[model samples]
Target: MALDRRWPLALFRGAVPVALGLLLWVAVTGGEQERQQTLKGRRAADLTHERRHNELLMAALREAAETEDNVAHRPVPWRK
Candidate 1:
């Protein structure tokens, strides 16, 4: 009867460390996953902004080129 009481106490002592270790492992990995996800989202947003900026630059260039072409076809009063 005394041995049976010791068995439960001994089991509880051994199980506590294992449970704590698992909880720590879960917390560490969960934080790492969240960090990685945040990095990925930031990278995606940066790429999207860059793409939009490039598109706007392209549109401005096209408009400038068209204006230049129009000017080239017109005669200037000071030029022959």
Candidate 2:
């Protein structure tokens, strides 16, 4: 008896669907991983900005207090 001629065609049909499914899964998970990385980067940048703002605010307050203290210590030149 001759060998069947349809085996290759059947195999190809089954494999194409499996291969497509795997590719779809990879694409979806890769997008999610990229999104998570972007969120992490944004959070780090926000924290850095907030820290810098606090440092500048503290410096300004210290300078203002020093100025006030100097003015109070100065003598009134018009009086004796």
For model 1 the local lDDT of residue 1 reads 33
Model 1 TM-score relative to the real fold: 0.45
lDDT tens digits by residue: candidate 1, 1-80: 35677888999999999999999998888789789999999999999999999997787567767764554446565232
Q: Tell me the spans in candidate 2 whose CA falls farther than 4 Å from its real position.
A: 1-30, 69-80
lDDT of 2 by residue, 1-80 (tens): 88688988999999999999999999889789789999999999999999999997787567767764554355666221
Q: Pairs clashing in candidate 2?
A: none
lDDT of each: 0.81, 0.82
- In terms of lDDT, which candidate is strongest? 2
**TM-score, one value per model:** 0.45, 0.44
- The C-alpha stretches of model 1 lying farther than 4 A from their native spots are 1-30, 69-80
